[model samples]
Target: MAGMMRRSLDAFCITFWITVFLAAISSATPIEPRSNAIQELWSSVRTLVFPPTNRCKVYPGDPEWPSDDVWMKLNKATDNRLLVKPQPQASVCYSGPFYNAEKCAEITPVWGSSYTHIHDPIEMMSPVAQGMTCLPPNVFDSHNCSRGGFPMYVINATEPKHVQLGVDFARKTGVRLVVKNTGHDFLGKSGGKDSLSIWTHHFKQIDYIEKFEDKKLGYSGPAFKAGVGVQAFEIYKAAHEKGRTVVGGEGETVGIFGGYIQGGGHSPLTSLYGTGADQVLSFDVVTADGKFVTANSTSHPDLFWAMRGGGGSTFGVATSVTVKAHPEMTTTASRFSFTSKDIGNETFWAGVRTYVDYFIPNADAGTYAYFLLLPNVATGIFTFSMSPFFAPNKTLEQTQTLLQPWFTRLNDLGITFDPNITQFDSYYEAWRSSFPLEVVEKINATTGSRMFPRANFETEAKREELYQNLRKSSENNRVQVHFNIKAVDPANADNAVNPAWRPNILFAQQAVRWPVNATAAQILKIRQDFQTGDMQRWRDISPGAGSYLAEADRLEPNFGQAFWGTKYARLLRLKTKWDPQDVFFATTSVGSERWKVESVDGLPNENGKLCRVR
Candidate 1:
């Protein structure tokens, strides 16, 4: 078997992936051949690290045509086609020392080692985990680039065997293998420095949509693998064409099954059905040991329990997610803007408090909602971007009545409620029409901070005031700031996803787009300003306030409370259980504190970041 494997590999690509499998290690131990599955696995990894022309190709008749026989045989044949090669004498290095022009030259054929179209790291991080542009400025720019600093490694996985091989490789290399689809991270946890990300972005296969048979449920959706990249709008649009709708992302561009749903996603139909995450039927995941598994209520129950809301990138890499899709029905879309600077801050605050107090108890849990408190200085008008998409089985008047107070008070305050309203057939068309999916995608890719699901809406007036102070902060600086709120109802108590999911009421707040850039000095001010404002807001609101770990800052300490809060300790055990070697890691990833102390074996490697798997 060994001789055959060697001869076959040499005939193919001269040890291509075998070199990666070998080069991945720092040692020169003799190689050994094993199962044919191992052979196919290496076949997939090569094209990924050093892809040729057509990167993401779909297998004929689909990979899982009958759910039993996938692309296993084809993958094996392809593996035989691409011969493995020897590793380069020296290890590949990312452009370092903050401006190595020669190293940057090494970055040519940019995607030479990349799996996606990344001219820079920012494109790679997306909005969730933007690269720190304090110095050289191009957050994504890398000389001789191999690292996205986000640890995103696209795996060209063909079969379950390939997935296991990738997992084994990551385990051996001490690289955290978080999964990704379309790189739509609201918080930057998916990719990080000192991490090896297994990007599912290339895995675009959708097996089947076993339509709901229960007539009473009136629900029909797809049982999809997480690799599907077409957005909620794409699938919903297709479903709409077929008289079906799935609860999914508002923007047509957001990846449907990627981290969004798993991380608690919301969309236009949210008001009607609930969050995209709530509609999940099951998750197809690859565990820490490289075994393929399904997570729900019964299988690997603890994992099922964690993936729901444990909020850890290290939990597992999910390939497919079966989600609930809904039918396209009539929907009303309206934009309510408040055109009055005379709308005193006090009045606005009181109105917000009243609205929260009133709606938190009665606003239908499934109703999608939000209210933006903005003072448009140009028009001497204080405006709010408040739009409530009417849920199915509900009327515009009924939604108006439920949320009437929010507008009536302002009307009484002498502001006209002349808002723009539109009605559409499919729930998605309306939401997709209004949301800047392109802009959102542009921004969503860069959103790095994650906000844990908030069960309640209660923050001091000071927080609002601080936001109001944002205009002041921007008054002298070059960067501008904005904030948004995502109000979500609590998941069913029986939900086994994450205990934090129990915080039925949740909201995400963000302030981004600093005043300056193009210069290190300008970038520093922008970063400092963002940090200062963020810290002040937290300190003023709740000095111990916690946010999502995905988009948290690289240097913010004491995140045990802020990111994980009460569940910090338990996540540790889970981390230990799955990643005992600390193979899966990020520079400041959640569970790495345990390994911060020097290892009895040696000093930290050049990476400075720990590599337990090493």
Candidate 2:
């Protein structure tokens, strides 16, 4: 009798699923009907037997999780490019099945560098975002290495179709999805737990288009269509070879066509040629419905506007982008440093005040200054290091002339420092010589940033206030300042970048780092102090100003307004329209407030199951 009942139930289930599947196919769109119907039927059947209480995304152990057969089918669909059950890059450091002492020793030395992580399929440059679960084994701890927040599987996507296949599979299977280009994401957006990742690091195609014309936008110039995997140095070199230059980030390994431009990339060339987003001609992206489309001023204008600075992994996956290229020009580079020990604290801060006062004039002169202000509490010393201040289209004498007033002021203040200024014939040469390789893998540090507008430097009182706040903020933290002001073009002002950036004169970041192997409570305290204490000082001064979304505090409050400002509403609307199902989830991105990552032990972490809150 039991067998008879079981047979009857099975028959009923099959009949119900077939009816639902057929109905779905009839109502579904032409592009996704058959596959959608099958996936819906499978999910419906699983829900009937084992219902989920939270309506959360399917986890690996859940009954609704895609079967091995389903993953196999996806692999076959992608032409067998799927990488299943991949281990973390640091897995070799631990006693694991893939352990190797020689390989571990070799990797351990360069493990902290961004170069080591950029080429990896799933490794992230920011280890803290990955929960620091698997790192080179240190003497302080004996924790076992795990995947942590890294994706469980990856699609080594060499083409757009592979990306489409990966997106469709994740959407259909109710699994988390993430897109990784160079793993250079600082906010953990490129990695997620129990996710199926689309690895776009192999999209290394670069084509230069001469006399590219866009009638709708009235753009006719030299442009380069770079693949998703193209890095800053690669594009810079390519453009230099063609006797042209492109606006890009300072970091050599930063992906240009992906997150950099999408987040309104600020560059040493920004003051001269506008932002990286402003230079964009078009983007080839795979939207939420797994449809590949090109977004430009003429076609899909809204998507184009949003894609320019809407932040990455929110609207869609970008496959390639065509960006404007400018004629190669000369650049003047300067490097100098002085410590408070040389001059008293009063004189050092006075020098800083003079430097702050020159921000507006520097912006007017189209100069980009990148420097660091580090104050050590224990040693009672303040160190100011200007690795290289970049001035484009200016000769060495012209650059020095611009800085003569500041130099005179320093001399009067009894501050002795050498201005190691030099000139390069090309922007690429100056960039190569000026900017040092950025160090990554700061697992214990938390950062917050602010964009200071031109008004902050207008009056002596305002300048004094800015200097005081900066000094107070740097008392217990490190401050990295970039005097990169955007030269906004009226034609491209409709992008979704933080509006505060338009009139901004400088961007300042405050960072706090704790010792390695700090306790969870200690780490929490450090992060809290950095946010509420150090960053709050900047926030109090810049009331209406916003921060650069790409390099901001991960747990920032009111992130929408902080990142997008007045544009947040429109960006959210576009996000809903393009990705209604919320298939994409990046930390602090548009429409992300509706979802939450269930962190472990009351600490902020992405290494947990993501679920909808509403």
Candidate 3:
């Protein structure tokens, strides 16, 4: 029986690689036809001799897994920058040889902040994606420590050559590959079980260009070339220092060039300028074939389009990206809060409806509002908190005038809430003071989000329906709403961003968390109820709308349509052409549907081996 099973696996591997080789050849550029064909043929034969068990990627304990000597060669090839046998960040908190009570105590206090995880080579911000293997001692009882879903080894990449070497090693050895930059990914795309990781957090070089000329794209403007590891605040401050600004994210720690821009980043500046992806000019990447290339409008246009908004870690590993920078301008910002304690549920929800009603006008005025709705039935408390509302290039009186209608409605409803508005001379000053430091590291919660299109608010009836659906969804989950809308330029509309986003007015995200010690069945129930039950309310009202890929549900159904919409088919084709060997794997990334991560005990995690399912 064992011999027969082995024969079957061998046959399947050969056939699979043969198909892959043919597909790759058809898409291979004429310049590298001979070399590409030879490489594909060699890879296919290698797979036939050492077939992956269950058609999965190579994992530890497998005969095909690299030997110590082989890893040493990789380490030397990359100037001894390879981190062998990397461990999880919280491993020291567990009862193990690596445990140190003092160090664990220090880590525990800052575990919730993204700053702590961003510095670690292998740590991810979300513990749920980390497979909940090891957490701070205070969060749970000290248990066995394991690497869990993190990569087995990491190349502390500081340059494009290091990324190329890592990509080549993973491809040749058939080991799963993942890229990590700042470890701010919400979908756990940065980590994978038994994978080789390229840690790009050290690529912190940023160069400012006073005049960036791209004749092919018919543009010449001020721009910045930022390394993949450059964070939001860093670029914002740098651009401000040069008397310019660029589209960026709300979270100060979010990487500007990696997943943030690649996932169609939305921001306070989105209303005035555009999405973060729209500001991109070009990307320098290491392709799957281990070649370093620059992808721009004139060179590798398809790859450039896919990388702009197709989602990251799919086509290639980007070393740096150049983005357009706009002139810095004055801004108006505000913060206010009201709760059910101040009013009744009906009036509170009514106030929320008034706020939703103004999303279109506010977006038209080039304003962005980030707010939260927290409803706790058990405590009989509901809160609406707008940490800050940003109105770029607008004065204090102008912003107040734009929001007067909503305030009038609130006054009519007898809702008294202070609109603590303030004006700043520069966008950086307002941004630094307005947006609060985001609290991360939610181990027990799973998140789902949707982008609500403008058509949903075309009529009063439709608007009411949207409000009621949101109110119902908020009853069981906290809802975060960002009023960001923009119409894509015809010249830049060919990218892979969801069509729903162009006509969208709101991006809302909701999270559902389970108890720390919940049973497997209980956790499964929470996830199912949230995705299919609570989130479905938002989905039903906004038919044909899409969700934000960066902050979307992990188990979103029909994710191809939900994340990329009409652009999914083209994105898939581009993914196939560039990464024919499927060298890169991230959860729900482009082409990820072809692979499956087997879970343990109903939890959604990357702890298991990744197998080719299609």
- Local distance difference test scores for all models: 0.46, 0.82, 0.82
lDDT of 3 by residue, 397-423 (tens): 999999899999998999998999999
Per-residue lDDT, model 1, residue 529, is: 60
Model 1 per-residue lDDT tens digits across residues 1-614: 99999889766674564465456433322124445655454444333232111121111142311111112432353343211211111113333444455543454333222233221222343332433311121323323433323333334454444455555555543344444455445444444443334545445565447563322223444444335455565576566666667767654556667666655555556555555666766777776665677876556666665555454356666777666555567665566655335666556544444445443433343455544444444454444556443344345665566556656765565556565656666665666655542332222112223332233344545334444443343332212211223334433423323333334332334444433324434544555565566544444434334554443454345656555566667767776786554545433444756443222222111112333332
Off by over 4 Å in 1: 1-122, 125-153, 175-178, 190-197, 207-230, 268-275, 325-329, 336-362, 371-383, 387-393, 438-491, 494-508, 512-545, 550-557, 586-614
- Tens digits of per-residue lDDT, candidate 2, 1-614, equal 99999999989877776565445334433334346444543444333222223367777888768778777767766668889988887788788698888888888888778888888888887778877788878522336788878898899999887887777666655788999988776787898888899999888899999989988777899999999899999999999999999999988999888888998888998888778888888999998877889999878899999998899898999999999889999999999999899788999998988888788988889888888898887889998899778899999999999999999999999999999999999999999999989767476776788898888889999999988988887776565555546455646567887787788888888787898868889988888877887788888888988888888878787889888899999999999899987888888989999888876644666788888875
**Candidate 1: lDDT over CA atoms?**
0.46
TM-score, predicted candidate 2 vs. hidden true structure:
0.92
Ranking by lDDT: 2, 3, 1
TM-score of each: 0.64, 0.92, 0.92
**lDDT at 485, model 2:** 63
Relative to the unseen true structure, what is the C-alpha lDDT of residue 562 in candidate 3, on a scale of 0 to 100? Answer: 95
Better of 1 and 3 by lDDT: 3
Candidate 1 shows a clash count of 58
Worst 10 residues of 2 by lDDT: 45-54
